[model samples]
Target: MRQPDIEIYLKDGDQQAVTDWLNATIGPCTPWRRQGQTFKCQAANGAPVTWLPNAVGKWHSLFIESERTPWEDDPAFARAAFAALGVEIRCAPGGWQEEDGIDAADRWIKINGEGEQEFIWRTQ
Candidate 1:
């Protein structure tokens, strides 16, 4: 079966920086022109992507809602985002599941400020 859609979160980074990276690496990204999204773009492989800022937190969401997304998976995107943005990144380990055991639902694979990948339990 095809892999699920990729969802990654940014802990801290300027929206413009993210926009620039997306425009350069993915495809030309334009202002979302929608109520909730910050930007909207298509990946090179033709997947729809959106950047959404959290209303009340440092974390922001990026959804690549197609199996055709360029990156292979969440960690791959996280690594690329870190290389481009030089900021912390987070994603559910191995993608999110309907019933992920071992309390993995709340766990994340984080790319830290220094670009080290580690498992973390996020409280916020």
Candidate 2:
């Protein structure tokens, strides 16, 4: 089976906020580990999930394997998840962003709250 794509972007540089959002959004699961500043976790299905901290900007990103992800097929759940985190999700792109003017097989989401963030999931 092909791996699904799901990405989450965060606005601020607070790692705890991201972890809180994940725990609240995804439910109580395994605890994420801190590798330096980034957080990594494994889903119940054993899919590797990671939350990367910002290096150049305040934006943070999350990469998850959507095939076994809890909210892959449900955008509402994802949106609600973010909403619960106190962040508003503006655009969850079905494909690539028009402003980027790039072509790719990845899916993405655009967020506008606190700080700008994005999530990209590779479909191909």
Full-model lDDT for every candidate:
0.74, 0.57
Give the range where candidate 1 is weakest over 10 consecutive residues by summed lDDT: 29-38
RMSD of 2: 6.4
Encode model 1's per-residue lDDT on 6-101: one tens digit a residue. 878888667788878887886775455565546676666667777788722888888888877567888888889988888888887676667676
Q: What is the Cα-based TM-score of model 2? A: 0.57
TM-score of each: 0.79, 0.57
- The alpha-carbon root-mean-square deviation between model 1 and the true structure, to one decimal in Å, is 2.7
Q: Which candidate leads the pack in lDDT?
A: 1
Question: What digit string (tens of lDDT, one per residue) describes model 2 on residues 15-111?
Answer: 5675566566555447888899777887656667777777326556666765666564324434754666665443344434468554433445554
Model 1 residue 22 CA deviation (Å) reads 1.2
**In model 2, what are the clashing residue pairs, if there are any?**
none
RMSD of each: 2.7, 6.4
Q: Name the regions of candidate 2 deviating beyond 4 angstroms.
A: 1-3, 24-27, 35-37, 73-78, 88-92, 95-124
